[model samples]
Target: MSSPQASPAASVRADVWLWAARFFKTRSLAKQAIDGGKVQLNDASCKPAKAVSVGDRLRIGRGEERLEVEVLGLSEQRGPAPQAQALYRESEASLAAREAAKAQRKLVGAMAPPMRPDKHARRELRRLKDSM
Candidate 1:
């Protein structure tokens, strides 16, 4: 007989940890990301069942956003957002890169034309095409 707090899990499956950490909505999604090479452990691609423990680094790519985080704790259960967030600590460099990318995206979005062209604008475009 021993105290419950005296021992904790030494490792968990990569996919399970990702889902538990809230990086992906579901374990299957995490598995897919791992298979697709969108997730890397310690700078190397790993299988979904790869073991993840504390202090290990993880790089996860989702859409245009990439995250690099250090594992702080281990959990196999999906919990509240706050609890999930506590499972990993993102590096400062990763945070800065994400912010810079977000700013760049905003600038690009500002330069894009509106969703719909006005009647006059459409006619001008048609006139240019007909002249060509």
Candidate 2:
């Protein structure tokens, strides 16, 4: 019989692991991300059924955020946030990069114009376009 510590060394499906880790809300979303090449195993693209074991590296791209983590534990069941977080250890470099990206996005958003222009602004834009 295997010991409790040995369970972390066991392999689980890539999608299952992602879901269990709380990377995605559901297994289907994890599978979709894997299929779309948004997830990588060991620096290479992997399928949903790929075996994920402890110590394996994973790069997951979700929306504008990219995370690089190393598997530290394994669980097939989805649990609380703390438990899920225990599944992987994100790299310090990845955390810094994400924070920088977020700050850049915030700066850019602040500089962007409003969604809709006023009537006067629209008229001025139209006049400018007609002159071109």
Candidate 3:
């Protein structure tokens, strides 16, 4: 018997693609952003159901950073970080901005002590609390 015909190329929803690509930590987070109109497709805002295919451009916002990327592949299953990265090509500007943010965070982290109060600070806090 002849093999069944292969199904035509099918695209996944933008939110699903983003989640599968590991762009967002959770599918709901992606959906929330999509519903809130924070994500853009080809420079135009699109809903969560907007289909995504290879070569499509996407602008995603997470926290204080924005990622500008071009889809390079398609997958609906979430995978490792390295594999997820293969699904999209980030722009140079995005990479640079991420690196800069990383560097800034590192510098700030180095300049400050751990957030936990030190013993001396704890004693001072006790004295102040007693006074109050």
Candidate 4:
């Protein structure tokens, strides 16, 4: 009988791929994202255990950053960054869009509100909330 370690195949679980690719820090985080519909296979959201193979497409949304990648290979074990990166290829358009979004964020950084409101500002915010 084949052991569990001998079960590697041409395809791999969606969550494991994400973790190995360094997209998520842990398998749990990747699984959580899958459950929350933040990860999609071939343009449709899929379960964490869904088998992902080479040539398959994926859409992943992290915070405000969205990514589209094409699977190039599969690995049953997690590896170093360079090796993990070999498993997928990001589309040029997706890379460009991410870059543009990053640029926009940098340009608008100075316009964002302070981290925390001052005591007077907080009082004003409370007054505004009370009126509603």
Poorest 10 consecutive residues by lDDT, candidate 2: 1-10
**Against the hidden reference, what TM-scores do the models get?**
0.84, 0.82, 0.74, 0.78
lDDT of 1 by residue, 1-132 (tens): 532212278899999999989999999999999999999999998999999989999999999999999998888788789888888999999999999999999999999988898899999999999999
- lDDT scores of the candidates, listed in order: 0.91, 0.91, 0.84, 0.88
Question: What local lDDT does model 4 show for residue 17?
Answer: 84
Q: Model 1 — which ten-residue stretch has the worst lDDT?
A: 1-10
lDDT score, candidate 1: 0.91
Cα misplacement distance, residue 3 of candidate 3 (Å)? 19
| Residue range with the least summed lDDT across 10 consecutive positions in model 4 | 1-10
**lDDT tens digits by residue: candidate 4, 42-116:** 988799999998899999999999999999877766777887788789999999999999999988997887788
The collision pairs in model 2 are none
Off by over 4 Å in 2: 1-9, 117-132
Backbone clashes for every candidate come to: 0, 0, 0, 0
Cα lDDT tens digits, model 2, 12-58, are 99999999899999999999999999999999989999999899999
